[model samples]
Target: MKGWRAQPGRLAAIALLVALALFAIIKTDDVMRANALVAEEEAAMDGAAILASSLSSELDKFSLLPLALAEDPQVKALVAGDRDAARALDRRLETLASQSDAAAIYVMDAQGLTLAASNHALPTSFVNSNYAFRSYFREAMDKGSSTQFALGTVSRKPGLYIAARVGPSNAPSGVVAVKVEFDRTEENWRRATRGVYVTDREGVVLLTSEEAWRFHLTGSAPAAPRDPAEDLRQFGIAELPRLELPLAGASGEIVQVPLVEAQQAIGPAGWDIHLIVDPGPRVAAALATGRLVLVSIAVVVFAVIFALFAANRRRRAHEEAVVAQRTRTLREQLSQANRLATLGQISAGVNHEIGQPVSAIRVFAESGSKLVAAGETGQAAQNFSEIVSLADRIGAITSELRRFGRRQPGEKRIVAIGEIIDGALLLLRDRIHSHGRDIDLPEEDLRRVTVEAEHVRLEQVLVNLLQNALDATDFGGRIAIEIALLPDAVHLHVVDEGHGIPAASRDTLFHPFATSKDDGLGLGLVIAREIMRDLSGDLVFDANRQHTTFTMIIPRHR
Candidate 1:
């Protein structure tokens, strides 16, 4: 009954019903809009197909005219025996090239010998070359007034060849071939918004509305034309017939006509036409209107729901915010408590550490006062020496405390690793002497290696590892310290003969708060590792033989 107040529950149920109804309506509208767009695109593609068929038919008619002209008596005489055949052929070619979109013309004498070529200036001499192996040759001699698409070897041009034989055919007569440049026809077709090309069985652009390049297999080559297909290939147009996979330059509709499979006219060759389409006006308008309608309905539904549950929604939101605030406050308070507990432990250590230095100073002052009261010169000198020693000890303890408490400096300098070990040992000297632990030093000649580092940080790292080794070893147990100089690095080792670090804990010993000590802050090794890394050195633990060796490696150059 806590959340069952009639106003909030009833309003929530009513809002849910309204939301579901609106969602259904919106989804239905979206589906309808998508289907309509698809239908419009299909209609546009059908129109492109009709245009392609009409254009192909027109090209078919034009292709036949070239063959008909080749059969003329005057053309035959010029091709067969005229000594001025080159000039006549030139005139005929120019006429044909101008009359139609043909690129060039050539004639063959009786017995299938090349007579003359239209483009005399062109470096191709087609004279006396049999046209027997060519597609146009086969069509003219056997098929009669036929056109074929093929790549010409001499000129390296791909075009349509319309060929015809004249006078005494079936025996061996003259032949004329008209070369229609498919590239020009392709260029004209490309001007439309949606356009494509068609080719015969030989991959020649027959009825094309798109730009294409020429590739010939024969004839003295002319200057190569600029390639338009370069950019088109990058835009995925080279995958033609497969062009319908997606629109190239823009989004919307695209269609492809696989002339070979779809129309069955030139099936062997990969002939196809592609159509790029723009959306129709009606479909565009429909999409805009549908979006507006959907938005309006969403607004109305939201308004009605808000009106029904205005007060209750406000109350619930406010309650949730208050609860969240309380939860965050509790978490913060718990975190603060944990921090204070940590501070308490560190404070106790600080007090114990400082007490020793303060007591020693007090004892030294008392002894100085006793010597002053006695007024004995030699005894006074001895008391003064004692005071000086205590003072030095106090100073040393204070420095170590300050160093441990303070932040590290950013400046770096060349520091000898042995110097760091000496500083740490000085601070531990009193404790080491009191415990009667044996300390060893490297031989004078072996301790010459130096490395680039922060001196204070290197000392701190050494002290941390040394203290851990001391705490682990029993009284009178051996703890060996060694410094080995290698070619690249100087290795500092602290090995303890007491119970070695457990195999499981060895890997994570350098991690924060990882310790075996009962009252351990668990931060010493962690801090050591961090400082070593800052100086481009590393601290690692190794349990090679029986001893647990903590090795600090500092690179000589770094």
Candidate 2:
């Protein structure tokens, strides 16, 4: 179990991978945060630029109103104090104001006394009021033209007042003023759900969607520097501190509660319009982006980890498979070497077995030669026949041994078990006779017991088993080969009348080179078993029995 566990190096590699993943997670979070910050800043800058452009375009449309009004003949006549033309001029002013979306249009003498106005029908009309105190009127008298954002004296509406002189500079007569209210502009901003407002040079919020923010100074100022009005009658400077103006100044948010701001100058009024948008959603979006990046990084990290792990596993398995194949090849090589060694050991026994037959053939031939000389022709023929039979036996034995000792895989076919036994007896007959042992086997049993096996290999198996039995038996001892017919296989048992295999040699009796006799290699049983198994059979030895028996069983032929 301990050996089956993962090696420390492999465990350490996994741990290192986990550490790397943790490190990646840390770096990924940092990278995500940085990227999110960059996106947030860029979005803020873009939002500001878009808002500034929209605000500037809204104010630029009414910039030429004062120049158009000043050149009108009706306005010029009214400015010259033509009392009879007052009724027509008033009608013209009211019509012009209504048509042009102006809050009010008025004519003021050089002394700032209002002559006529679009709102003259109202109780708070500009007809009698002296607007000499108003900056737009005074600035036009001196500079001929000016843009001013102020509270209207007649309508009390906050508007941008663009005014121009009516007469020549040498004899200036009056100022014609067009007051454009930004109520629609403010409404547009409100509808768009944005915070927008315009501030004059003095930093006072003249126009805003929030009515309560009017007249409030958006920034610190030392008393409304370069005040537009000579007399601040309509606008109470004392109440400026109490007005609540929503502002984030030039930078930062410009909403009612701003985080960033975009400021642009309104061309006609010379005022700074501040545009603010909520930053809550942008901050939320940045956070969302950071989370998404982290999640994506985590997924990639885990995927890489999984792939690495799988690849490592496959590599290890391939290495193990290669190692196993190498071991199997080594085992086969060793087995083949052992077989060749066994063949060398048995060759001497084969020479002795063949010598006996040759000696017998010579003896029978000499007998036949003597009988032929004595003129017993029939008897001589029988003697010669016996010599030929012995010679054939010798040739058969030598041929089978020569073919079996060669390094070749023998072909398998259906063969009778008796044929294998007869071949083995042929080779071992001299040894059997030399040992003075009788091998018992009935001719009827030999042909009926059949097996499927290679002819030479089967003969080799029987020879090895019978040789062992012949060697173990005492002089004049009996050796028996008994065939046991089974349902699936044919079993041949070679039993020897000898002292049983020693207890100490029993375990490794069939082991190669482990032998009881000094000259024995102990590979006989090993080779026999190997041969039997190659024929889809097995070798079993029963040393515990009264008589030692070595059985070679091969599968029955169909």
Candidate 3:
């Protein structure tokens, strides 16, 4: 009756509907991701259990070897004042240690004293003191064969101790101990695990792989340069007692049981084998794929629903067009509102982005003007040249921003991509230093890529990428830009040793008004993408390597 009155309130209703739909879609996505993460953690825990079981089993074999040698009649006769037999036994032990992963092997007296060791060059005066109270010695006394772990005296390293008893009759007479370094233990465990670390009951790390060490040492104070001995002293075993670590997190209390609980005698007390499995990459990949599928379905459904709603709400084709126009206007108003809300932040970013080059130009102009007014011809010439240089820099900045923001079609010209990338680095040099970052350009060999694109716009894209990289990487971590020339296209890649963009956020990383950062307007990557597209190029995320890389590719003959 009211001539089908247009209600502006209906626009609010439509926005509310879109919001609810997006909330549902996002909620479902989060649930799926959570479930996937849980599953991955469970799998990793199960794998660790299997690895522990396998390591215990392998230790049994090593334990048996010492027992066999101790019980051998020839070995007993040799140790019983038979010099020739002792020499032969020492040779055998030496050969075993040299051939296998063992570091040292030796026979001890019935008193748990060191006797003939594996090598003749080894000091026999090194009596195995403080060992009678050792669990391995007790196990050899009772169980005939046992394995334990202790810090090495000579090497100042941690080693696994496998010991067994040798006797003339059935009664045990002496003990034999085989010392295997912790590296060997790690190597064995690495067969089924990513990283393995052996620590004392106090959580003091004993042995770990080089890769694992890198992560641990990252936050430590920088160590002074040293020789091998000093290096070992810093990282190796010490006489200082291990400090206890209190368990505070969800993992609960730390347990210091024997390697075997009841009677298996796998190893000694105060020793733990910790396995670290990096499930990040696998989980990220799986979650990304699943998210893609679910988002695709949701997007398709939402589009169909929106079309149906439009048709139902507006009967005529012209009416539908008017409704679409209204929607566009509403979107624009919303965007303007948001921008207004962030006026301060926008102002700050604009200043940060433009302040330096403008200051440089001002300085140059003032210097030149003062010199010319004084009629100092020589100084004026120098000042003028400087002013020209500064003006050129200001022009470059403007050109870059223009090309980034505008939708002008590209003019293709054969150019070296590396030169453009270096130019970008030059622009950001001050910023990089201010932020405590080091940006390393790729070697000439890696950067020589011939491509066709709008030169100034391409340089703008490169500057954007390198600056982004510097922000992402830590002070000591590397940021590398590489250029590769392919048969059909040229690729420019920016790699950073930083926490990568989350898999969940990758899709919207280049989208306008989409960002995880609190201070960002979300226009940088969007502008970068548009420029690349105008140049008939593409920007994409590449996760093939350990470092995260953003790759831009433009056709060679465009």
Candidate 4:
């Protein structure tokens, strides 16, 4: 009887040990699975955010097109019933649309009649189409500008239409619109993730990687009910099909449906991008890792704890040393990279500075050859002399580039303002004649004023400014150079009859890589400003002027 009682106590102790082991295994698995799920959710959310940003960037690329087109003189004339401008405007719009990779660009009259379109040559062209009922057109006419996503009435394709009102807001003449499609964006999303979709404020899917989910509603009901007629016009469907995504269970238990979802807003648009992720593999791996950890803890509890602790301390120290070495190496690499970047900028500057002289040289050479063939010996000799001067200019440019690379300052001396102006104009004479643009030089006495500066650097700055003016001015446009003598400084103003710089671009006018020209490197003004500052002078823009103006201020030579 005593032996039986003892056996019952032993059995109870064994049962208690088994229960504790089971509890530990279950607890470890739960914790590990939960952590893994959280990590997966976070990663999915980050991915969704990145995708949303990309979509926003894509949309932004074409957002300014309509506004720019709205300001076009040809578009304005066409809107004013100038039928002769339609042919030229159509070709220009077609070229612009092709270059910008936009789906379509079109101009509409006050009646919302498409007057000209980029696809006017095609059979399905938007020309002659009336979009008076379209929200994009109506909204733009009322609000000055608007963006609307809808299905194309004729093409039956979904795209975002960005529209801007032409002329004054109070009496708008017409509207300019650019359509941007998300075909490439959707393709990229399809390759990057599964079950990616974008929903507007009404929970209707506007864009999706899965074609079947497009135009589907997100929840049981729309956020705001839309008019049936508007819904039909926008999406070609009055009743949108609900999206049926497999969602995870609410109990925090790993269920058979292992999908996790994340949502991110795209720009100011009340559109949300959703990314769906499958966490089945991650959860399984976490469970396996937990089981292994439990086994390891049980085996190493008493025997290897102290040894492991000491080894861990040694390993940490070694890792710290390694990290310090890596940091030093990284710092050295970064220094080297900075040096390379500086070298690249210098090279780009040299390349840009040399182009004008080289072009002038070619023009002189060609003229000389033609003159020689025509038996005009004196004129040919003059052309050859100009070529030699251009070659000398090239040599000076190279020398300056080398000195700049070495960080050596150029020697400054008193130079007449007329000398700088004459040198720059001489180099660009052929270009000026070819473009039929005129330059109004300062008065003879005003040109006599002297400034203290490096001759080559000052001439380079002037040349850069003149070249920009030449580019900005239209054929037969006039550019005027005016010199004003201050008590301690001389101001050289370069004014062009071209369109003034937009207010939005004024902040970055002198910043590197900020340019309005399509083929410009955006380094000329930056280099010119730096050169002026180095010479104890300054460069500034006059924003108050009706025309474009750049002023260079130099210390007056005593």
List the RMSD of every prediction in angstroms.
17.3, 32.3, 21.9, 27.1
Please report how far candidate 2 places residue 387 from its true position, in Å.
99
Report the lDDT tens digits of candidate 4 across residue range 1-558.
999989989999999988998999999988999999999999999999898898888778888889998998899999999988998889999999999999899999999999999999988799999998899899999999998889999889999899999989789999999988889988887787756888887788889877878898888344676788888998899977777767443233556536999999988666889998877778889999999988888778755767878899899999999998997576445333432343463454456557877998889899889999999999999989988888887887665445333322357888899988886665556567777988999999999998888775676677778878887888999999999999999999999998778899999998888998887656667767877886899999998888899999999999
- Predicted candidate 1 versus true structure: per-residue lDDT over 2-94, tens digit per residue: 667777988989999889867766786677567666765676567557666655664575666656757666676775566665676667666
Per-residue lDDT value at 297 in model 1: 81
Q: Model 4's lDDT to the true fold?
A: 0.83
Candidates' C-alpha lDDT? 0.62, 0.72, 0.62, 0.83
Candidate rank order under lDDT:
4, 2, 3, 1
User: Considering lDDT, which of the candidate structures 2 and 3 is the better prediction for this target?
Assistant: 2
Candidate 4, which segments miss by more than 4 Å at Cα? 1-18, 220-224, 245-258, 298-558
Lowest summed lDDT window (length 10), candidate 1? 213-222
Q: Single out the weakest 10-residue window by summed lDDT for candidate 4.
A: 334-343
Encode model 3's per-residue lDDT on 351-432: one tens digit a residue. 5556776787678778878978988879878877876776676676556444434444356678777767755654565566
User: For every model shown, what is its TM-score relative to the native structure?
Assistant: 0.39, 0.45, 0.41, 0.50
Q: Give the TM-score of candidate 1.
A: 0.39
